[model samples]
Target: MEKMGYQKNWNLDKIFLGGSKSNQFLDYIKRLEVLGRDLERCVKSYTTSLATNEAANLRKLVEYIGEIRVNLSQANSFITCLHSQNTKDQDAATLRGKVAQIESNFEKKLSKVKIILANTKQDVWESLIETKELEDYRFVLNEWRENTDKHFSDEEKNLISDLMADGYHAWGHFYNALVSSINVNVQVDGKEKNLSVGQAINLRSHPNEEVRKESHNALESIGEEKEELFAKILNHIAGFRLQVYKKSGVKSVLEAPLKDNRMKEETLNAMWSVISKYKKPFSNYLNRKAEMMGDSSMKAYNFWAPVTNSNQKIEYDEAAILITEHFSQFGTELEGFVKQAFHEAWIEAEDRANKSAVPFCAAFPLTGESRVFMTFGGTFLNVLTLVHELGHAFHNYAMKSVNGVNKRYPMSVAETASTFSEMIIFDAAMQKAKSKEDKLIILDEKLKCSVMNFMNIHSRFLFEQRFYEERKEGIVSSARLTQLMRDAIHEAYDESLEQPSTYSWVWTPHYYITQSPFYNFPYTFGYFFALGIFAKAKEKGNEFEKDYLNLLRDSGSMTVEDLVMKHLGEDITSEEFWEKGMEICVKDAEEFLKLTSLDDIE
Candidate 1:
């Protein structure tokens, strides 16, 4: 039996088999959906009726809806997990689709409620919140009120929502397919290797310089061939986004992401400002690395190449123990969850055909259970992968105690706990480094990752900004988009790279993502955010843990600033708050310098 606490193999049958096919399950679902619809209607009717402050009625409606929503989402959690685990599973896929359609139908019906609520007097909303029975939903009601200004006429809002299925979303799918299907021919040891997009990218991290450069060339070559289509997709998506942003009265498309991030412009500016200062240190790190590799200058392709040496391959069991021991510092709850995750086969770690390429965790919210997906082939990165996914699992654990209504954290904060976990475990690993070469290898890994979050992610953010700005003018040509992307990259990495080694072509896939523009900033944000928060924990000692957990607990309930203030007493909108994180970045450079002694290595 696997020793991890949670089982890796999920019981999809719990959701859809046995009693699932029976009338009881079907009846329960139908009745729940009906109740949901009814509750929504009640809220709308009461609000629109203007019948003598029906605060009690509103409370009853919210409570009923909350109960039904929890049950419905419990069922949804199972279906979602099964669908992801086996997208080809016909029955599961059908169930998932049906659930989604029902949910959308519910959303459409609820739009009426939103419109009604929007028309409600501010005094009425305040009275409802002050009512004993309705107080539970105060947060939800307050948030809705905040969004009232963004609410368009029901007709336009509904039309836009429905239109996305055919328009903007389709562009995103096309872009993904184009990138995923791109074939690259890489030369290795005098042999030509045909690679998928992912394989080619992974090869950029190869120890062999020739392999990395060849892979980079192959990737860029394939991207060049598809540039026109990629540009068209980017332009169409951006145009669609701009139209919607204008319609919604958002100043820019970035406003939504930033608002959604619960952060302000100053926070981002401060983070990048600090990152900008470290460009010199990064340049030094790269230079030192190049000298160690006996190269005059390093190309973009050689960025992920291994430095110095790594330890002997660790067994999965050994890695689990190491991670468990490291995570124990957080508390027994986190440790036990990590242990359960490994023991119960909650992790699909085996390398198998027809499996996902990246590591991720999916939570079964109903049971507060989670499954981790990854292909672990015993590399150190594989261990880190486990740690990262387990970080997500830990987040799920923290959220489990929250109402399902308040557990869905935004994507920007979604990475916070996971990245925080990575730092904790990595620090432990770094401390145990046994030799100078091992220390170099460890520091190199840290520095490379830091560079990616700061420099690479910054480049993507800049390109996306330009893409959105220009895309408003209509479709950008492939060549024009490429040039804009190059300019964005050069601007972000101004002093980070030495002459003649820049690879501006890397913005290809990132710019092509459809659903979220500026998908890149979240990474850098998560990194610096966690670091800043981590620094607070170090200063305040054990007392900070409660505040931190409370902040996490409120992630679903409050604005990002509110959460930060509750936990770390810092305003996310302030430049100083972000610069604190940046200062840590500088300290990181100093540590790298102190530990590695680049002079000797060079």
Candidate 2:
């Protein structure tokens, strides 16, 4: 059965019968609405009578909220699976809106309770969290109390949530649907073929230079054609954020994202400082890659082209075995979990039209299951994505049985297991290389990943920061956004790109994620954070697995600084911690340069 190529389509019937139109799923949705009202009532009761009914009320509030969280995670994950599988799924789209409203309602109610905790007398509030009933939740409770807003009334919060579901989130949903529905024509293997956005992306990694360039051209054409619509979406979504921040007297845009990520400004700066100083090495790698490709420098299309252009096809079945085999070297528990995920048909890697271009792993804690979404192109790069997303699935699996509050980790540290898994697979690939050329190919992939995390991500972060600054004054036009993106890439990539990108801002999903504010930097933060741990793994040798597992389990329960200190014995706020990760990447780029110069391949 494992030889049947690991079942490309996922078994969502295990989640809800009859897919999106299921009456059973509809019933579940109705029940969630009822639970949502119950949660709000519980929030009011728990907030108003902290003295008389502190013990019973506190337990009720936690129980109702926890139950709601389980239901919400299940409903949202299922519909999102449907949406991504077919962005044209109108039934799923409608259900998505309903689920968003329910989630928004629940969040605002939870927000009100946090406000109450901040206003309560200190001794009484401490006593409530100190109770045996809430001992496990004390950390999250304290976090809420400490971070509660000083502005925004209950009605104001509710109004914002209602508008957010229809306005802010709706715009993001529209963008994904529009992009996925778009079909473009590209010449692949001497034949002109119509491809969806996802398929076009697959061809961009083609071993043929012409294929990669043509595919990127077609994909960018979608961004260009949709530029005006995308610009409005960007402005409106960002406009919503700015208005909310202003309404709450928040002066800085980064403030909310930093707080949401449970990270300090110093930790972020520390990561970027390493990237800023070390950009030249990755830029050098890019230039060397271009030279090898018979070009002086790479254009936007060649930014992610396979360096060696290996036509090696690592089919899905082989990928499963390789991922688990390499994963087992680190730990049996993780390897076993990944194998189970494959056998259980938990991943949707179907190469189909109308599917999402990007990859993600969605955690459904209520069912103790996680679904990974991607188009498996059967390249080594696809295999890396396979391992990376599965790592996210396992992270959720590790913490699945924990209470909902404790399992809700911030995005900052969430990439630990995913990128950590990537290193295991990547290192294994490099070690198993059969020749100089093979080693160079694998090393090139590593450098590409590093470039994405640092230079490409920095360009996005810069664009967003400046875009928000511009959006504050007025609606930023499509031309201006393109110019901003171009300027950012030029600076961040050290002006190495032969033709800097202008359309990245339109397709980059990070800019549109309302759920995670400032979504791009956390990726780099997580990448190098995991890289640091991977290096530690080499030092710890046989003992690293246990420590790594402990780190993943505790990710949601600790602050970014405290978590790293406790697990890795390092301060993420210091340049030294990030410098270690940067060194690993820089060495790869240096090696790539040497290899290119030493061996001239036709």
Candidate 3:
């Protein structure tokens, strides 16, 4: 694999002919538009009750909506893939706007269908879902009906959907553009150089303390410069959401995110309760890390600071081999998928100018394929990212045979497979460590994961929660937002930092997105969820491999609680279950302490 020099750019031609300008792509767009219109016509033509026609029209509507959804996903994925590689590509941006319009139009039509379903008699709707054609989509239909029950009139829903294209969602795009256009000047080798916000943020973990501080100050300066504009962006986005919630008669803002996560409020509270008890261990680990780095106390920038001095670099091909070897010990199926993802042109792993800063894996339901995006910098963390994304790709592969509608899992469970894959690589490296330093490096990575999921994400969740609570009263000023974020950080982590981060709310993009309200907690939920499953796998040994795949395959078809109960035989809403997960983090921290002490002799 090293000799082959694996393909680093994705083959977009597999999605379309000429990457957005092709005749084939244009024809496909027209077809999607026609399908939307036809579906609308079919729904409008059904005036009688569902029982009058044996749900024939309802079945047709479900199939048509599914087809439209799959095609739209393919189009959106391709345009995003193109835009991520070249942020300045106007053609890709224009196509994305057009796709957004198409999606909004489809949503309008679907809203009408939902209104019709909501108006149907309960007995009739229940019987209609029992039909052979609609059997697989039972959960989907029920969810639509439930949401419609809480919504306003069809006219208002359609208006909201139409306005969101240029109203709510446009603000998110505006924020993205604002941050992307920012370039910070930093001194490198005694020379001033310009770096993108994404590039500068990555420097927080740089080996040099001065460089990390410089990078952190540069990023905070951007927030200071544009504080008012940033405040307006957040205020309006949250304000618009509040207006919709009020009109829909939603009493609590957390209702939608909790529903989106397929979880109950009890589960979230229980997990956080368990999480709070384990923070001391992680704080201790951070203090030890600070001492290892010759510092008395850890600051915000020092959270991701490296513990070991090893500078070993692994090539892209070598990283692939390492991942394959480690995964082979678990199962042959996963090993094969990882190899195929690299051997084929399914990943864009090269580091270049103007590319997106984030790493993600996008799955195309229409083609039953997925594409992963990342810049491979040859670090151990980068290797972990590769395996993490491969875990996502494997999840998509596991559900290829299932229906597209059923394949949509919540954000909470979405990270289960990815984090599980990271654990595999983490343990493999720990076992292969030949020296104390090597083992320390591996332990550092594990402890860093614990700190991130336990502390950093907890602060984010608190910030969002408070931001929403205040946004409902009135627009929050930039200073007020800063204070709120600082308070949240203080509550989550009791570390006395040299310089506290007050601009976290401004640079973090999670607050700007309207589609998912509380995106922060799902990460913490996913880490713990995967940790619990991994613990079970360890206890069951190789015999659990088949059940593991089965669990992944069913992730999309059922609720998280149901999936856990059936596969792991544990109640996720219980405090005991969450405690079991948090114990893993505590155990890892204790192990790190033992490894660092001279009394330990293996």
Candidate 4:
């Protein structure tokens, strides 16, 4: 495969002329204000009647609202890219705040339209859904109708949406700021240095046992010192959600997330049931890993420890080449898209101080572009990160021609392309490994992802489930939160660890996000979902590539179950479908153990 030149930083100029202060950005904001006013007028003028002209006007209004949303997303994505590159950029922070307010205003206005649609006569609404102009948006229109019962009155809905900006969302901001500012003192090489919570956690993967132990202790200390505050944050967030749920007459807490994910409760239940049955294999992998590390039992900190000491670091250029070469096997389009991403400077992989610690791919629908952010440290893990994010970029590319509204996929299905990409690269790497030790290293990396998705994320789901259940009774204290976390971890891991971290909930930022409740399980969902897709790809080879692209393109237009059924001809709501994915993990675990044994003998 021919190598493509990679850009060190993303080209944000393609979105707007300036970062946050540019006249172009200012002009975009002004346009948003005008659009917001027009949308408000459109909604205010809407009536319950279903006249042909009114239906036509309604379609136009919906399209206009979608346009505004796309522009807003573009603005938000730009500012976020700026903020992520330089966390200390106060200008970016101010712009983000302004954008949030603009979005809130848009939401309040959009609620009126929602009320109009929700209250429309069933026959009229069905007629509108069947209209030629609105045929592409039938799913979104149907979703609006279904959500009619869950909504408050127009006035009440607007009030809740407005209040959520400064009320519910503020708590999440507070938690983010507090956690981001937290610095732990760790002694590295007989000198004490201050490290961010994320940096400290990275040490857990260090080759030295002492470093991992020290980093773990440092994290535990911070959790101990701030548990009460963290607990308050979680409690208040959950309490607010519960209060809203009760006021809105929502039957169950899970209903909101399941609806948001466009997934059914039975599907979630089926997936978890299959996952629960397969825990032993992951536990066995962990035990074997611990034994390889010369430990009596695996500590929580040892989960990410590397099995080999190769210290081989592939440069960014080499990593891109490797990813492109492997992706080429799937199809020309995928390979070309990845090459374009690298050549066009769509990725920001430079490591620098004050950059966001997390890796993410931000898609700008209005511009039909995506930007990837990550600190590449020239490790195998970094290569995986590159490909993983490229998976997201590929998905976005696949749907670039679709309307923005139809491109909005649920988080549950969002990971399908990315995890499938990882599977491709990992399989290729395993095949190309020259020795048992090398293959063991690749297997270990693969299993690490599996353990994270299956075990770590599963524990988070269990904890949140119990937390919400108990939050209905009253406030949960910090100590009690710790106990809940430990209990959940024990249950998920089957009590395999000698000591489970009680403060696990304290460090995770997922619990703090107001918009995304139960954000953890989607990772597990996406992983296994992708696994099943990967299995199909393996069986059908090149024939599956077209279906995979189609699946990615349609992700935003239909429910996950429907998408799977249309593409793979499988029922996602059954344990049988998820069990196929679990069987892959079991096979990987078995292969990992065998390879580790062979490496030991060699």
Candidate 5:
């Protein structure tokens, strides 16, 4: 293997000192299972003392919950590292199931706490959480206690949580396993070659027009062939969710996602309202790119085709230096932390095959360390990906240090730091570009990401939104789901492309995720939320660093609206704050269009 700059592999040995068969890892799980039993006993005691020593028992229960959380985070984060580093590791897979069972056992007992809080009278509950021992966790406890009547009773809620581990989550795991077996055949250099879904996704960006089109059609055909099984997976998961909502007295499908994101409907409405007005400029960029490629219009396949005939690659060490140096320019301590992540070999960036292609950063709570996973192909896009995952690592570093439930934040605000890191590096790339083409590459890369958040994600959100409305009537057939997908694509693209992607529901994994509902909008929320933060940094200059770090720290402790007001002092439930993000996208698209319209290419 050719050695890249900095060691391409991460140091997981420091965490466990051995691989999947480590005896130390086994001992850790044994200790965790013992703790789970203790938590169950603590819950039992708390329920028995409800009348006499209610406050004191509740405090004791909180301490147990805190300890259990650290145990779960350490174990789960370690197993996730094992799996990502080698997807074919069967022992790692078996250990994941073991860790999951421990987590399930923990959740069963934890559900009792939620139900107890739900039944508590509002005045009494307020006074209970206001006590010295409980005040630190008031935000999370109040979140559960606020919507008391809309939830199930103790017996019903416990049954649902237990069933989900086997029934609901199993369906999700099966869908993932099934998708892994799908392979697409395409013609490559006068020979037929088989491609995995991940490989076919890469071919969509092939400079040759025919290759791009072939890969897209092959994947679409597979979706059509597998629609029946995929449809069952989609319907069963959604049907189970809708049934739970009906029993819980929740009126709309959006309610769970809104509450889960720790955000308000008004804020979601405000963000999408601004997004709805920005499609024309993005569509113009797509049309202009199609023209540059000598096509009358853009298709779903052509959307990823490169307009610049440049093949530029940045080495991993160069990317690391660029990311950390620029990160320091905007904050008090971001740069130093980034240097530690690189020098300590905390990132898994080896470029290899048979490895899971998903990229992420996992945080080990007890160790106060993080592991970043990605196959770092040498490109500007890869550099940005490294920067993006580091942003997530830094967010975890800022949060959860005090080790309580409040350290855990929602998906919406959790994305703030990662997206902000990308913005900082983006500025650095443009300012230090050695040539016009390099600058154009940076612009094109930014526009592609912006377009996805702006247009593609909107289609997913609209499709899921409408699918829920119709699911209330009855089970939507596999055929109707296709049309529903088309309806969303049509509305979101709005004459932007010659042909839009319609078989998305057949391939999109978001619809099958059992835990996260409405997996689409948090992305847009995160993107623009970071843009708002970036715009603030630009407006306030270096002094804004303190607030930026402070905001990341507080993300887990408050509602999205409350966090925004406390940090930026901006009204996010209105259109004005969201418009700032759209403006940044608009300017990027316009700049891309200007650069591509030159006579030199002609």
Candidate 6:
């Protein structure tokens, strides 16, 4: 990548003091926090004095609330960014406490406001957006309105929100504890090595079949022993959410997630319907993967096995160049962002002490700066990950202009820009392939990924849906949950797997991820959606690039369907929309097979 002059003069401490003494900064923050409380208190206090449609008072309240909110959030952004980038930094940690204090105090003040809104005239509150300048707050306002209907009382809502710090959220931490503590004893280099779920599952992608099998079996055995506890947790969390959903007048537990996604339930169902019809194509890809791995009886554990020989290494500098070259095709703006990311020292590139295991991107809008956290070890996957995360930085860069409201897109669209960036890098790589062998490896890896994203992920989602449904009636027994899982795997994999049962226990984590219920489908949706969008680009040729970037830019402002319709001239709800995307993947799978020829050898 070309140097964009970010490294010449940059210091993190200039923005944040980085020590406990940053408490001095808290005076300004605390003042703002108190101002926020005053604003909330004022709004709630005057709730009885004015009618919902009282344009003047309502406008004043909304504007004041918006101002307090922006100040509180800006302070929040600074503190959160520092803590996330360097958790051990004392200033950041101190600021985190300050931010928590602000939220706690603000919540107490806001509780009355919430109650007032809940008990108010519904139509009048809904119409407040038009009367006020807070049009960007429609989603949050709607959510607040929904909360009012389900609210027990101001005291009750406060208690529930407080207890949730230790109740629902605590359950999530407990689940994480269980996952972290699980020690699967797998045979590595003829020695028994104890591994965590993250480590063990990764072995399924190992080049060695023996390592993969042992890792898979050991991983399953560990989860099998704890299945009952896992089932209970799943049961408890599902029951909790269903109760909340019912009280809120929401028809389905999925209602909240759908709302959170900012799309209709019908759209999600439509996307999956298209996905289900294309399962055969996914199965065919899996079968090809099995043949490539020389497995007569493939199971879920074998799903991530390397189907092509591409242990290719890349230098960090070269990786940056590839990223810039690929992204530059989109336009100069993205190229500039990519260059800035690499040169500005926005990325923590090499694995080092005090760094976390996973990769993430954090943006600081106060300075139009973004920090990428990843340890680049020069592997192809690492390079791809760099591109993936840089994609996130690029996203926040585009979104910086939309402050406060309308800036936060739903989780569904959050992946759009990143996935779109991945497609760009992959397509560029494919185009520049110097040999058929290289091309085959790239093609096979890409399709193998597509199959896993679409099929394997869908199976996990299928199981979660069943588990939640069953849990609604009562607690699902470990044995019952296991059986349900096997059924889901059977349905999703169908005839693709020679033995799907062996890997049934692999999805235990999904059953227990309390913080993110039904986390499986979003990944599959993101992957295929990007494929659909990329396919459109192919059809439009040169005219597609501007529209693609424009769609990404507007992801924060619009619904998923609106973005799709605006760019692709198609609605995601239609079967044809998904079929087109799946067909493209099928064609890629065919190319992967023809080039690999491992099926012929088999």
Global lDDT of each candidate = 0.66, 0.85, 0.82, 0.83, 0.80, 0.66
Cα lDDT of model 2 by residue, 1-602, tens digit: 24646788898998889898988899999999999987766665553426724766676677668778888999999998998988878999889888888898888988888787788888887777778887777878889889877788778888888898888888888888877878899998789988887788777578887888878777677788889999998899999999989988889889999988999999988888889999899888888888888888877677667766466788888888888888888887887898889899999998878888889998888889999999998887798888889989989888876777788898987877888889998888898989888888889889888989998989999999999999999999999999999999888899998765588787788898888878989889889988888889889876887787778888877898999899888988899988888888989988888888877776
The local distance difference test score of model 2 is: 0.85
Each candidate's number of clashing pairs is: 16, 0, 0, 0, 0, 0
- For model 1 the local lDDT of residue 255 reads 84
TM-score of each: 0.86, 0.96, 0.95, 0.95, 0.93, 0.82
What lDDT, from 0 to 1, does candidate 6 have?
A: 0.66
RMSD, each candidate, Å?
A: 4.1, 1.8, 2.3, 2.1, 2.8, 4.5
Residue 242 of model 2: what lDDT?
94
Tens-digit lDDT string for candidate 5 (433-525): 896566667787788878888788898999999988988888888889999888888778766766666887877778887889988888888
The regions of model 5 sitting more than 4 angstroms off are 1-4, 48-57, 148-151, 185-194, 434-436, 540-542
- The alpha-carbon deviation from the true structure for residue 582 of candidate 1, after best TM-score superposition, in angstroms, is 2.0
Clashes, model 6: 0
Stretches of model 2 off by over 4 angstroms after superposition: 1-4, 47-49, 52-56, 130-132
Cand. 6 TM to true fold: 0.82
Cα lDDT tens digits, model 1, 1-602, are 24543333445454445422434446656776786677656655553523336777765655565556566676665654554454344565455445655655666655665556667777766666687765656777666556654447767766776666556665764554445445567887689877656556656566577888788777677667766666666677778888888877787767877766656777677767767766777677776677667776656677777775332566777777788888777666677888777666667665443332335787776666777776555556667778878888878878877765567566677777877887877677778989776776767767776777877788778777876777777777778767766676566666445432223433345554555567677778777668866777667755666666766777777666666777777877766777676666666666767766634652
The worst-scoring run of ten residues by lDDT in candidate 4 lies at 46-55
* Candidate 6 lDDT over residue span 451-516, tens digit each: 666666777878877776776778778788778777877787766775454335434455455545
Off by over 4 Å in 6: 1-36, 48-128, 131-151, 177-200, 225-233, 315-317, 348-358, 363-365, 374-378, 498-516, 536-550, 597-602
Better of 2 and 6 by lDDT: 2
Residue clash pairs of candidate 2: none
Once superposed on the true structure, which residue ranges of model 1 sit more than 4 Å away at CA?
1-44, 49-52, 63-97, 134-136, 149-151, 173-196, 309-315, 498-516, 539-547, 594-602
lDDT of 1: 0.66
User: How well does candidate 3 match the true structure in TM-score terms?
Assistant: 0.95
